[model samples]
Target: LLWETMILPIIRGNKLDGYVLGTKLCPPEFLPRTTPGSTVKIPNPEYEEWLSNDQLLLGWLYSTMSSDIASQLMQKATSKELWDGAKELSGAQTRSRIVYYKAELQKTKKGGMKMEEYLTTMKAIADNLAMAGNPIPLPDLIVQILSGLDAEYTPIVTLLTDKISVSWIELQTNLLTYESRLEQLHTYQTDGIQANHASAHFATSSTTNRPFTSTNGRGQNRYYNGRGARGRSRGRGGRSSVSSSSSFCSRRIVSASCHLFYKSTTLFHNLGMCPQIMKCRYNWSYIKF
Candidate 1:
């Protein structure tokens, strides 16, 4: 009666140290017998008690270690190698804790820890790092671990795919387009003024000694007089003269044809190679091939 009166208050006050003493006072087999029903159905209360204490101790240890590790990771501002190593260690520790919790949860017949709880904790850590603007480099490793967990516990592939797709988009958007700049240059060159006033004036003025008058009211003298006009007229009238030069016209046509061919080839190559373009296509079977 005295033991009950003294110990009951201690247990009621939630003093686990005193409760341990009380548990020790009872015979080891006493708990299993009082649990009721078949012997095989009874839990090992002592082991459960030890596991509960161990879980508290391990949780504290991991939390303290994680905090220190995270601090160390943040302390080295310029060393990518150090940061990567720290991130790997952090992932390993978190994965180990998850594995431990998963095993413990499986042993329980009722009210076990859920995988969602672990995922929430992992996501919290990852989000915190992301908010800091320097996410961990081992996201692929983390995804692999999460994917394995999903396969064993639940299907989280959709969530993983969503995350990876964002990164893929960012990567693809940063790719350089060489053909685009080349096509712009080609268009600019082909459409630009081929000959200027300086070259035309030199050609006309060199044939005559007369001073010319301005014809366009811009105060600049026109160079072509009667002699210069006759020279230019003869130059334009004959096949051997400047205007009817088949070589120049043929060269221009050849250049234009080459430019068109190159532009078409570039467009076809980019269309076939572009990831966004490749996603749209009818199969050969759909085309009756």
Candidate 2:
């Protein structure tokens, strides 16, 4: 059989065919030429050509193999020997080989491989086993895939394990989706941290550029607005060292020209000290009470 067009276009497109495989070209020592009519064997010519082509084919086959297989077959005497040895070696899916594949599948952790790569690797192993006459059941395949995952995938693993049945395709899709969600969550958290940092930096810069004291004169009153003096004042003149009292004067003290609100009606002209709000016109030490 040759590389089929419909099954694998890539291999067929590469121009490799089963021509060499179907035509068993004998080694140079085994043959030289074929007689046209006589049944008896006769070596006439073309032994050199056969030797060259066989060695060339053998090298080509060796180049296509992995290092392990190539190293094992590197000492074969001819192309046909190498081909037959390779076939015999791979064709035997013995119990030990099956066990080895299963162990390999079990131990293949998803450590740092991305979601797609991890799944592809696992699937490749399963496909190999299937080709070797030991197909793993769907449930076991799903279980093996989940078992190979790290702790970060525990949430999805738990959800799937709790169910009685799950398909491989479904599990694969879910893992990829979960991976995407994890990536998005990480991105959003990073963005939020960056925003908070920027906000803190802006606040610090604004504070550094701000003034600690008022820029107006002590006589300036914020309440003397063009609209009207309607609210509590906010100016240097209104600054006082004392707390606001409940009445015009919380204490009774002598004053010369300041007035006080006594009992809400009586005006004690010379009996109390002036409140900080009052614009006193005289000294309180000379007051007559």
Candidate 3:
């Protein structure tokens, strides 16, 4: 369990030095070299057993070291292959790799693997190799050999491509659906507002009275008591009685005449009649009072 969880990533990440050191301590050839001698035969069996156990440990170590180196080479080769596919895509691919590396590094917070780091470093090396136009590295050549051993590679690629195509179609469909819904909602709201305004206009038109009347030959109508001259005299007499102690009596007759003329002219004007009276000209006489 510990080997699977802890040590596998180190092997996968291409940190070969640690694996090599561990494997060199124990080699499988050491077992077969032990012989059954006349005097040494007694201890020979134990020695041979020890060699067998060591060989098992060494085998795991060697395999891990080999895989780590291979993963690095594979990453570099894959980058080159992608670049060779399209020259225009090189920068975009490099940027995407960098982003992927950064995100992977961040995920290493809880004692994660070194493979991600090694792969990132290898990608950088690959980018440099591409820029220099140099020959492919030996380890990368070995990776190409190893990749051919996996029969599922083509199937995995096809599966991933199909998934990406489906995702793109789904995304486009969702966007179009959202845009159509938004347009419909906007149209509905606009129509509702216009309909409400029209309804309000109709209601107001129905309730409000017309201030002007062409049927009566009047531009505007005015309310007045028909007994205007008599009404004015009675109003003045009532006012005089109420303020009898004041000097308003000195201008009483002039005030009464001004009031009667103003009412008469205003009434005639509202009736669409051009009154012959020049009462407005007499306004200065009332101003002096």
Candidate 4:
């Protein structure tokens, strides 16, 4: 707020206080002519306005500095003197700050941070470097940005570098695009894997509860044949009565007499049958054993 509302306006108005004592001393045009032999001299016509403007600028400069800084510049009568003093006083600090920011840039990395965050930090460091009289070139800045990225971006970086001239803006756009594509690919693969797992589970369950199987003759199957099928119990005279239920195999059995026969029962036994939301009857025997 201070910079925009006060400092910028002051600078733009050409009224920013700075050293001008030397310029003030120089004659503009010619000093008013003095009588030929008389020692009396005429004042420069602009001296009054010059003195007025200088004092006004001087006051603004003094008011803007901190007490500590103001004290050091108190003796500076002109705007230029104050400015030079301030720069000389802050030069060491500025150099140190530049070093700190450069070190941070060198050490910073994307790591788990977002791409935007990393780029923003790098830009800030670059700006500070420029302010410190060490402005980075566009290509060098782009290199620094790429160097700080995570290892995951290596392939993309390689691809981009190989294909086109690398610019910071272009790299940033490509990186974001790549990130979105990776997220989509991961989501697609995850959904596909879940779907396949669900399919396999349904198939296994179907095979396990098959209506009838030769390996387990007239055994306890969830779906029963409509035909009166019989099974021998453990005892010699033991009798097995078959009952039908629509709770299971309701879709596969359209009629009480309908039966299912697979071309490769063994294959189905291992992999199970595909799950169907609706069952349909196909050619098969409703045989009596």
TM-score of 3: 0.20
User: Across residues 1-289, which tens digit of lDDT does each residue of candidate 2 receive?
Assistant: 0111132353235433232354545534434344786555455356666666667766776776779878877788776677667776765534556777888898998988898999899888887677666889988988888988888789999999999998777888899999998887666545544543454444344344222232344443322223334434344544333222222222223131122222221322322322321423354443334
Quote each prediction's TM-score.
Answer: 0.17, 0.43, 0.20, 0.57
Question: Which segments of candidate 1 are over 4 A away from where they belong?
Answer: 1-251, 254-289
Ranking by TM-score: 4, 2, 3, 1
Assess candidate 4 and give its lDDT. 0.58
lDDT of 3 by residue, 91-200 (tens): 45556655664444333221232323433444454444444334345444223322322242344334433452343244334434544554565565455445434544
Model 4 residue 254 lDDT?
A: 24
Best-fitting candidate, measured by lDDT? 2
List residue ranges in candidate 2 displaced over 4 A. Answer: 1-100, 214-289
Alpha-carbon shift of residue 131 in model 4 (angstroms): 2.3
Clash pairs of candidate 4? 17-79, 18-79, 18-80, 19-79, 19-80, 19-81
Candidate 4: regions farther than 4 A off: 1-22, 26-49, 63-72, 193-289
Root-mean-square deviation (CA) per prediction: 21.7, 20.5, 26.6, 11.2
Error of 1 at 181 (Å): 17
Model 3's alpha-carbon lDDT is 0.37
